[model samples]
Target: MGKKKASSHKFLALAAAAAIAVPAVSPAAVSAKEHSFKDVPARYTEAVAYLTNNGITKGLSPSQFGTNVSISRVDAAIQLAAALGIDPQGTYKNAGFKDVPKRGQWAVNALAEKGIISGKAAGLFGAYDAITRNETARLISLAYKLTIDETVKKTPFTDVNAQWAKYVDALVKSGVTEGKTSSRFGADDHLQRGEWALFLYRLAHPAAKELDLTIMHTNDTHAHIENAARKVTAIKEVRKAKPNNVLLDAGDVFSGTLYFNEYLGQADLNFMNLVGYDAMTFGNHEFDLGTKPLANFIAKAKFPFVSANVNFTSDENIKGLVTGGIAAAPKDGSVYDAIIKEVDGEKVGIFGLTTAETVDISSPGAGVMFEDYLEKSKKTVASLEKQGVNKIIALTHIGFKDGGGDNDVTLAKEVEGIDIIVGGHSHDLLKEPVLDTTGKEPTVIVQANEYNKYLGTLDVKFDKNGKVIGHAGKLIEIDAKGEDGTYILEDDPEAAEILATEYKPAIDAKKKTVVGKTAVALNGERADVRTKETNLGNLITDGMLEKAKTINKEAVIAVQNGGGIRASINEGDITLDEVLTVMPFGNALAIMNLTGAEIRAALENSVKEVPGQFGGFLQVSGLKFTYDSSKPVGERVKTVEVKKENGYVPLVDTESYVVATNTFTAKGGDGYSTFGKAYEEGRVSEPGFVDWEMFRDYIQANPNAAPELENRITDINQP
Candidate 1:
């Protein structure tokens, strides 16, 4: 704080504006003597000098500033009035208070007349009582006319009452104080003389500059750690340009490549640690290996996990690691609903929301359950706001504009206070930030595409009130090789070393170790597999059936969701890496006893949205069905037949059949409610044979592993 002029030019101007007439040389000038206080702490030395240099306060004995002594209500009022350029001895209309004494009567009356001070009771001012932090807040706020952030529902302090929160909010927003601690405001505690000096000094020279925050985020990285070195280079470039930046992942750090298959998220976590990720949420695939592996992943995280919608309370492995609600000082290697992060001297609230579909699509097991995304999101935002945090970011794993389930666009439109959404799941490559102006404040939504293709960066400028005033975003390609096949970005040496020394050797060997040979190239393209059944999908289901028959001879029909088939086997030696790449989720085989009618229902669900690329499209073995695109969804299946020794026979709706499929589809993933019903009814049993292993075994046993589609699924309406 700068020393105030001895002439009191600004104070006199404020007095003139308030229409308070006082002697030219004010009471502040009467005791304008600066003395070195031996008792003043080092921290408050400048504030003490500022107060005494401007004659705002005189030492008790001209040497001791009495910094720790509590200032009484009347004494506080006199100082506040003088600081605002009002003379304590000036004539002013009396505020009716029976207990008012003559000593500082005019100062209290002048402040009361101007609505800056108030009486404790109807007819009495607590003149001799020590002023509290709340009272100090109100006094400073009114004296300086600090803008009260009405948006804040709570202050950082737990001790602050509802009535006093607004005033404290004003003080905090104006950069006057950050409470007694990050979690305690000490609202009822007596205001010390040194604290008052600091408050007054800050009020006189307020620093309410706009804060510019940069967010470097990734999503659906899916263990594509081949580009870890490139991503590190991109992240470092942004951090160098914008020192105030946070690196975040929107989830799906697990599943996709052999890295995750072999190391179970450890390789990716190592890269994340190198990149210094600020926080992450869980994606459906994070639970694909069930709770134990996920718990292990959580245990190794160097950064906290924010999972507002995921309930791990019943999971013994994860329950102890979770810290519920908003955490002011979030610890690493833990989980919380939300957290307060201070950046550039401003509090930014960040939380996580995973899709509730995880239970249906992945293997979260019975203990870990997901809550409704919207409800949990609203509560998390409210809790963060209650802790006086206004700048909120929803680091989400929900898809962007996904029509089938919860997504980011709907989140921005429905949630009131969310300022930014860094998203994943649908793997949308948002080249530019999507601005949603539908809410009370503009919310910016951004997503980087899947498999570590790009690193997304968002820069937002927040005004003094914590409202986003401006924003810009872009996707930076984390490409190691350019169009000409030359390395454009140098690899970060440390990250390259980790990959070369720790992971590359095993991954290279796995890629070269051939599992089997494919006579014809299998098609698992998104447009083909998710629409019409592909040979690759058929082969996957056929392998599942071959393995299921060993455990249960009754297993005849095999069905697999097209979504579970990730890649195609080339028309050559199929290596372990290629097999893993195709079935990277590590879905175990499951056999279900379902009535023929339930089978037909599942078939209907599989083809309902087709010709439109539904992920649940069934690639089957031992069954064939005809469906007309023109028919209604529920009635699309025209005919169903079972494969018997004598060839095709009409299906009996009442007869029970043993069906084999991946655990994901059997558990009702991809909107198979019929399968979900069976699983819930205890009619499904998991044989624990992993899908890739089964596929590998099938391919190895039959060297000529050339599986072809034999009209297993026919769209009758089409050619």
Candidate 2:
């Protein structure tokens, strides 16, 4: 990527002295029913009327408008910059404010270059300081290059102290201070919203026109469908009030509750469809059930799933699921690409990507692979460019930079030719877009907070060449106030009747039945299990081992994949519903006999694909071993031991021991092919006992008790 030449049109400061004469109010100013400025001061009548006509300024109070309020330096800059027709995007050189953010300092510098107003000191801009009425008028006059008559003398003011003598004369000549009844200039007063509108209108357009483009968006949805519906309603109302509109999602649209888990993303897809989501991409949790389920979701979705680097071809299951017509093998690279659309006559290209950590921390069956995002993004952009896509958008499941190991920042810094990056995954809320330093192309990145609590809105403008001209974005909270519940499924009589007639009884029954109780919370999150032992996995495998022992006392080991334990048990009266959520899949327990050598081989094979990356290797009851990755494959297991009722016993190399695990791993999942080899000749038996039922019994017998997660599992020999 090559840097473009710097923009040469330096911003100039507004005039330090107020200038220009007030004009007569036109009929157009007061014709619109929405523009009522009865409380405006007499001196600002023309400016107020002009602003009201343009739809920029509306009085804050019906009877008493605060015209003497001071304006913050940043607010003043925003107003004056909009008046001057400058692009309010990109980074500017720092104006030497010790507290101003690096990103924020750009706006300050841009205001300074335009000579809107000088800072308190050289290289220092006190952005937080207030702007007085006279100061604002002068800045506005300078920004508009307005000139007042020099022959006019200072107007009479009872409180025109010595300090503002020169400014008073200039303001009087410009007719900006004619309504002032006293000598006081109200220098410390905060500027009101109405005052800002009047000032900007007078400075920019004596006769303003309504602005085009109204954008609405949401972020960090996390599958909270009901609240998302409310946000959509609010956005629609705003859209009805505006001329042009676009709706967008920042990301994190799936994976956070029983609804997502139970239906495997069907609920989220249905809700997003109701909200009319223009586009979305994967969040980290979107991979919770792995590639196959994710592809199933994409198949059902109407909107485009965008990502650049997530390659689905590496996993055969994912390839079959994402492709609509046929089941393809893992080698087909076409499944994991991007979607292009033409919205409102603008050629838009969207791509998606998730964090690389998802490969290890998510579900075991996510056979897809993640490549270097920047490299893959470049390829995607080039391909889109070849397809005549000039406006590119990245729907990223990456997250905001929290000074942590964030890949989104890396993507922003390395990737170029992107117009906007709608990001999620970290759950950080960004009210406005962050300009990346990738190139002069101006990439705007934004994200909303987690859950369906807020909606992000962005209004962007483009030139004839499809280059971004301007944009404004904000986050709107979805509180109950003015929430009409139009988007709610409960509001629909038919839907409510269906729920009452069909699903309500089943839901009530599931909730009422007590399954068991737990003294402590069980582990369910991927981070908890992939990197460490979990009580839930322990209890589950313990049940399997116990069941196997009943059939054969020789059973010495039990292992289950951490991914199978979907939910944690909090301290409470456990219900059947909770148990079902935890162990949703009805996987039968299987027992098999394997020698100590074969057991060690199975463990080695579990860690082979990505060493120390097996969440499925979690075991309970009998089994203890230290694995060193630096050693050769067959020699990695050291000090292999089995648990007896009394204590630990050394594993005999030739002695046959019964092992128990779920059918998934027994048949070979997570590359545990060594277990498959052992099962080929060993006797296998399926116990009729339901795994969840046994788990409930175990928890009931040991109330408030959780399995002890000792650091018995160790990793070694990493080169």
Best by TM-score: 1
Candidate 1 residue-wise lDDT, 656-714, digit = tens: 99999876787678988888787666577644356777888898988967888799889
lDDT of 2 at 61: 46
The 10-residue segment with the lowest total lDDT in model 2: 10-19
Candidate 2, residues 11-127, lDDT tens digits: the string is 111211111221112223233235444556666775565444433223444433345555567656654543343444545555565644443455566666656567777656667
Off by over 4 Å in 2: 1-216, 238-253, 314-317, 320-336, 364-366, 402-406, 482-516, 519-572, 576-719
**How far is 599's C-alpha from truth in model 2 (Å)?**
39
lDDT of 2 at 256: 47
How well does candidate 1 match the true structure, expressed as C-alpha RMSD? 17.4
Candidate 1: worst-modelled 10 consecutive residues by lDDT = 3-12
lDDT of 2 at 478: 69
Top-lDDT structure, candidate number:
1
